[model samples]
Target: MATISTLSDLYISELKDLWSANDQMARALKKITPQATNAKLSQLLEEAQTGIADHTQLLKALIANQGEEVSKEHCKGMEGLVSEALKHVLEQPPQNGPVLDALIIAQYQRMTHYGITGFGTVAAFANALQMEDDGRQLKDAVDDLYDADELMSELAEAAVNREAAEE
Candidate 1:
């Protein structure tokens, strides 16, 4: 944890944090994706893992592009979120069915919302520092994360929730 005196320092630091976050979420997803009985939810989790990896690579590349050390500080923020997600869906998970799927959606959204905030904030930081290319790339990552979040919401509203309610 280095002192962040400049906007560039903050931006690069946030990027590293996001990289750690993506890695944590990726590992958590691997543990829980198979717990999803709903095919759609499982599929979404699979796709999200790939996207997270891609975003992690982007974070690394962005840090290197800034001539930074290309290393990540452990993201305690995401550490907590992943902890809660696993506790909710794995440590004491719901039954392996629609109910579980709904719970998974809820937990997944919580993590994604964290990601959305982090990435969006970093994008803004990049723009504030006049790094338009980094800003655009990060904004694109935000969009990808948001799209995944939205699809989970749609899946929940259209199917998972209803099925869980009937359960």
Candidate 2:
């Protein structure tokens, strides 16, 4: 990693971090989706995988535009979160259906929140750099992530939590 001597350096670093985070999230979603007992939760996880792929491409293009090599530094934050989620899934007893789905939703929300913050931070950096188009693009991605998070919340409140309570 390079020293952050300027805002541009910080911006590039953030872009790289997001790239790594998205890659980690893609793998996590694959593992999580199959464990979800709720059909809607499973579908949402699949859709999020596609969104992560698209966002990764966008991050690469943004980095390349800045004359930086398209490479990612490993994001330890995301790595830890993913590892914790996997631990939860693996360590828990296998008989609980709704309870497991509820846990998955919680874990999914944590990952989405990380993405929301990362994209929002990059968008702010873009705005500071006077790159309006880049800022708008990052903001759009942030909005999509927020929408997914909201949908997950609704799913949890409407069905998953209730089912889990019965378990």
Please write out the lDDT profile of model 1 over residues 20-48, one tens digit for every residue.
Answer: 99999999999999899989889999999
What is the overall TM-score of model 1 with all chains considered together? 0.98
Candidate 2 C-alpha lDDT tens digits along 84-150: 8888875663468899988999999999999999999999999999999999999999999999999
Overall local distance difference test of candidate 1: 0.93
The clash count for each model shown is 0, 0
Model 2 weakest 10-residue run by lDDT: 87-96
**Whole-model Cα lDDT per candidate?**
0.93, 0.93
Which pairs clash in the backbone of model 2?
none
Please state every model's RMSD to the true fold in angstroms.
0.8, 0.9
